[model samples]
Target: MKPSFRLLSTVAAAALVCCASSSVLAQSKFVLKLAHADSADLGTSRKAVMADTFAKEVKAKSGGRIDVQIFGAGALGGEREVVEGVKNGFIQAGLASGVMANFFPGAMVTDIPYLFPSDEVADKVMDGPFGQKLSADFNAATGMHNLCFGEVGFRHFSSGKKPIHSPKDLVGMKIRVQETPLYVTEMKALGAQPTPIAFPETYTALQTGVVDGQENPIPTLIFAKFYEVQKNVTLDGHNYGIDWFVLSDKFYKSLPPDLLKVVTDAGKVACAEERKVNRTFTANGNKTMADKGVTVYTPTAAELAEFRAAAQPPVIEFLKTKIDPKLIDSIQTAVKDADAKK
Candidate 1:
């Protein structure tokens, strides 16, 4: 059975009392409630691994002074709601994907279609100085502290009908997209009629022919069982999906200096582990999807270049109006710097 928050609070209070009674009054154990939208059964989902790793590492590093409680499968709420919970201090931390960018538009820069050339490029940019600055900017704007950046990999198109080999294939097709302007505009630019739908409702949308296809990372495509409904999977790799580790400023500041360090350091460790697992899963996930009767397609280099060029202008134009031009320039410079090191 899941442990109740009341019970955990009571236990924490009792631990504090015990410490108070001791002559030395050692640091008492503190409990942090972490929430994410994915189910525990998805082995490749970074959120599950992150929760497990963060809890284990923080406990080990803090010498049992910090306890982390994980609530997965939207048991807490959706990404937007979870972000709100963290902001209000109702929850200590959240594991959210690009949806969180809705609250911090500066993050929208990462969602620019075709900006990342490859997975290696994405890693270099996100794990380097640019990523750190974006995290800091997000925290400052939202009043929440961002601990680390983790990847969900690049998203690709999956459909129940014909294979998507080029931008023209997407023409007149109704593609499901997250309710984000970046996604909608990109899809429209590529010739598909973008349909914004909540994630939980996507399967039915596909089943009822409400949408012709949807795009997602391989792990998410597999975990969501999209392979069951979709006959074709295309590795268009239009956008790099990113996940952020966000902590409540209130909760973070409440911790002792050493404990705070433990949380931050543990985040970095968890990010490394999660990135390794995600990379390996992405490599094999296509084969796994194909085995399940989904026809997988990888565009040739020239074809991919054409796709990238076609999808770039609309997103760039859209961003020019929505986000600061200087912030956009800074992001471009950061990507260039990351590439230079490689």
Candidate 2:
């Protein structure tokens, strides 16, 4: 009972159709949406702009099969909120730090005062074995995969009320700090009353005398126009900030191997470029604060050491309640290693 030629040809045609459908299914496209809480500008928002570069690179490299969409400036809420969204698979990716310490307490290690001697030392420590461990710890705690780290520069103190030449100058001053316990502890230890304020309201907070002073990288102070309201600036370099480029474990797992490589490579490129911009701003752009009528003050080595003695020990004691001191010790060791190399 052999089939006729027409029947055999019809069976072969159906099999071919099934194979074509399977091939199409295997090559399905993936779209991931990444978010950040910066106003949409490369000049002001280093991480936001670089995260966008990650988006563009993913699209171009995936040949349109993978799309990384970006939402900036609280479009999906602040950094901590977006971090929650990503962990739940409600969002794909983001660039965040600060309140992220709440989710992954180990993250606050990066904010420890007087940790890095200079930007070069900080960079070496962060890109070395020490940083790798922190990234792994962060991934374990929060389920977000770190791609690369971008710089947030060193935070300095500025005041609208008075010039801060020493820790004594900060006494009786009301200082605004990011909504983090460690920052609060740091200010209290330095003899200032710490006011926890949201990022968006800081300028007005300064102008209206709600807060006498605040601390942040010079670039951020310039970008946010803090110089307009705060006339006194001091280079304290108390804390080094890191922008973590991360993808949700859920979204990362969804990608096929090839597309993952594309995302990872793009992240590295964006990280490098953003750090470069940060360094350049620290060297040249910071002088603008003085030009804009904000009195810029550089602390002597002895004065800065007084600040370190006053602020760091108490903050470390405070952090011991939240984070592993062992981790902090390891980081200190790494910083020393970096300094030794220099």
> Please, what is the TM-score per model?
0.88, 0.91
Q: Please write out the lDDT profile of model 1 over residues 152-188, one tens digit for every residue.
A: 8889999998999999999999999988788888998
Instruction: Name model 1 segments beyond 4 Å from true.
Output: 1-27, 42-44
Off by over 4 Å in 2: 1-26, 281-284
lDDT of 1: 0.86
Writing each residue's lDDT as its tens digit, candidate 2 over 136-230 gives 99888888898888888899999997899999999999999987778889999999999999888999999999999999998888878899999
Clashing pairs in 1: none
Each model's total of backbone clashes:
0, 0
